[model samples]
Target: MKKSTLLIILLFITIYTYAQRDQTNQEPGSTAFWENLSKLCGKSFEGEMLNASEKDQFYGKKLVMHVRTCEDGKITIPFHVGDDHSRTWVLTMEEGGMIKLKHDHRHEDGSEDRITQYGGTSSNSGMSKIQFFPADQETTDLIPYAATNVWWITLDETSFTYNLRRINNDTAINVKFDLTKEVETPPTPWGWED
Candidate 1:
């Protein structure tokens, strides 16, 4: 009995040592955030509208967000509302270690929508749990009305949030997804196969 107990203790010590080493070896800066987000791939979560504009009727129904694709330097998440699956949020690690967020909107015919691929890059090396993106010049050129838009995303043990606020206007949208609840994955977003 004593021999068995000693073997078990040794095994736990080995596991703990490796776990500590892995934590210490994690990449610095936003890499931690990227890694955290990547861990959610292949999972879907239900979300609630914290605050939305009156015209934002599209999000007033059952909402689900799935971490669909995750790659070396990019992750694409699909947001589905009711029967609409036209929106996907793409996060990419840009040059100089910055992060960029883009909205990929598409139609049912596998074509891009008129207001697609407009977002911004992170202005700082944000914490592993949160990041803020301000409108870029390209976004301003593409959507003149959203020249002063800012988007923020946050993730923690309990929930994840996607928030948007316009500096020029009083527009604000916040959607919170419960991380503890794993829901059924929704259908593919528009323009995506399978």
Candidate 2:
């Protein structure tokens, strides 16, 4: 019993140490990454209500994504889940534009089933286009096919917003967001039952 316990503990330590090293060795977040994500920082923007298709989802229940940035050059996007008034968020730019957007879902025993992921890519648009790549399989599934949630974020001093939608069949059924116009919107993310 003692040997087994020691082995497990040592394994956890090794894993933790590796994760730390991996994070520290990552590149810094691109200026474009911050500039793009910062567009929605102060505004209390809301999206339109929508729904999910056969394999699609909107996560409606009144979830709110609050954008903010700390002094340490880190970005915080807090997503408020309406069902239990719980909150999770996407913390970015720590080791480059690596993002970890967590969910409020949980297993039967109260163990949160939230997902952590990485996103963002090389500054390819003269600070205009930043690729939000999926770091893993789970994150990829969340993407809406070729019409995935990958955004082509356009940023400027006047406004900051993103459009996360794609064509489903012959129609753009899951139009996730279209608020880059710098205008106030409905109380939910667009592209679902409203």
Candidate 3:
């Protein structure tokens, strides 16, 4: 009888531990959105330009984004456009349940770009699959003309979309990647140690 009781207790403890892990992994409230994004770590996806009306030359090439690093409070994705591997998008969970997005651009020699680290922070805890970042004070100071920029990211089972629009200027950029099919992981982004 005592053996059976101990066996039941062990089983209950195991189930309880798993439940706690699940809860922490898919926490409620603000962390829900971040947890969704964190699911893509160590994966690469191919993308295409969604807003072809703009006729931008840079984005017309083969585009790939690799979700390289993921931690408790941060995820780093490197965006590669053709042969240029200079841009990395960093998503960091900030205090007050806010999320911050920063673009780190570098040159072939691993030097920082003149306009690097330009991104914004979330104004609210967005939906589980989408988050919007309005231009923060840092972006306005980096490039005054981009003061009205608003960036948003959406993630679902089939696709992930990154979007940008200048509220006052009508400038827009939309890039969508296929989440259903992951491509081969690309090389390290600029400035990253091998």
Candidate 4:
């Protein structure tokens, strides 16, 4: 084979290899999961605490969640428990296809709370229906007792569940919402712009 032809073939092979690697690193599973969740934007659902205890603060409250905002690489969900609209769940797609979950908490005056923005990034490429976020360093720094916390979310055609578990402990919270039913969207969460 001619030297020029050989060089051309080598370059083509290198480009193809790099392209494949880049695509693979994009984490198709995570992307699919994001897309699936984004489809629920602007919808609202009523939720119930699955493992509620008498001492659980959220017990017997009217729990609602709104998939209020969906933007490129980001989704914002506001969780309302009775009259408390201080919590919003933000899912951001990070570089290399990871997803970061952050809880934005605010007071009635729309001011940031002291224990806010604590969550973690997905440790691996989770399935299209679920993803797990272990406590990130920032979370541990802000809330030392939550260092062992792991939060996972699952979404399907009929339901969506948000769960938290503390490794090596019995502390857990599981809230499941019925996707089959659409509820009225709640008001803007605290600290969120209209």
Candidate 5:
């Protein structure tokens, strides 16, 4: 074969190999779920507590969640409860078809809270519309009481729900948002601008 033709063939082979490697590294279902959630980027939605108790801190407050930032491998969502802008959920894509969920809590001055960056990674290749994250070691170490907390999110065409349940216990929280209606985007979450 001509030297130039040989070089061109080798280049094509290298490109094809790299493409296949990337595809095999990601879990298809997780990737689809991530992309679906990413579609809501820059939009804000209003939500309500599905199981509210009088003792619940967020029971009577106006709840909002803004899918504020979306990037190649990460998505940042700031959750607002009435006047508080202290909670942000950070979802990051990981190797081997896994996704990590971390709670980024900040103060008004954009400083990290003492209890922050606590969450877990997906244990399996969940469905395209849902994923589950069991509390990681960091969460258990930071808050021993929440060692059994399992957080899961479900996204569909019309609604999105964030849920938490402690294994072998009765503690659970569920918040459902209406995706059919877009709400005014809230201000930035604490400590994010910096």
Candidate 6:
């Protein structure tokens, strides 16, 4: 009798779980739904100088990627060069949540530049590691598959800042992004994903 009762209880729980998931999928118009679709937003951080010693003599230029967005195991970074407008960076999550920043760039001439590798970092420990890939040869739906390079990102609520470096790229060396601003985190599409 005890075994039968336990089996019945388990069966009911399984049905309830499936019912909840189905409800979420077919729900009517909701801002929450749109928010859930957009996994990235509401992140802010301060940029700054980094220890040039990490790369040693091979250190690339200093740089910064501010207000980067990462959600659903992916991150799209938006950054501006010194007085040089801005460009979008796409990074994707890999095994262990390591970030491989897709190598891609747009020239002022509206042309695509070669994908070069620099270096990357993550704040939430090893949850994310910024590694370099060749170019957008392949990518997941989460990122630009054409990207020859990319990065992995782990989900975290706290804001993080990273110094940008261009290694083995045609750009100049010793460039760094100094964090000089702070902004409010806008509401997440998922509302409470934070």
Best candidate (score: TM-score): 4
Q: On a 0 to 100 scale, what is the lDDT of residue 56 in model 1? A: 85
State which candidate, 3 or 6, has the greater lDDT. Answer: 3
Worst 10 residues of 6 by lDDT: 185-194
RMSD of 1: 9.2
Position 40, candidate 3: lDDT: 85
Clashes of each: 0, 11, 0, 0, 1, 31
Model 5 residue 22 distance off true place after TM-score fit, in angstroms: 19
Q: Put down candidate 3 lDDT per residue, 93-170, tens digits, no spaces.
A: 999888999999999999999998999999987777888999889999999988989999988888999999998676
| TM-score of candidate 4 to 2 decimals | 0.86
Better of 4 and 5 by TM-score: 4
For model 6, the stretches where C-alpha displacement exceeds 4 angstroms are 1-46, 51-64, 68-71, 95-97, 116-125, 128-181, 184-194
Taking every candidate in turn, the Cα RMSD to the unseen true structure, in Å, is: 9.2, 16.7, 8.8, 5.9, 8.5, 11.7
Write one digit per residue (lDDT tens) for candidate 5, span 1-194: 69999999999999999999997786688889998999999999999999799888889999999999899899999999999999999999998778899999998998999999999999986889999999999999999988999999999999989999999998689999999999999987888772
lDDT of 2: 0.44
lDDT of each: 0.90, 0.44, 0.88, 0.94, 0.92, 0.41
Model 1 residue runs over 4 Å out of place are: 1-27, 52-55
Say which prediction, candidate 1 or candidate 6, comes out ahead on lDDT: 1
Per-residue lDDT, model 2, residue 182, is 38
Candidate 5, overall lDDT?
0.92
Candidate 4 segments exceeding 4 Å error: 1-27
User: For every model shown, what is its TM-score relative to the native structure?
Assistant: 0.83, 0.41, 0.83, 0.86, 0.85, 0.36
Segments in model 3 whose C-alpha atoms lie over 4 Å from true places: 1-29
Tens digits of per-residue lDDT for model 1 on 1-194? 99999999999999999999997787656777888899999999999988665578755699899999998899999999899899999999987668999999999887999888999999876779898899999899999988889999999888889999999677688899999999999988989976
Model 3 TM-score on a 0 to 1 scale = 0.83
Q: On residues 24-53, what C-alpha lDDT tens digit does candidate 4 reach at each position? A: 677578888999999999999999999688
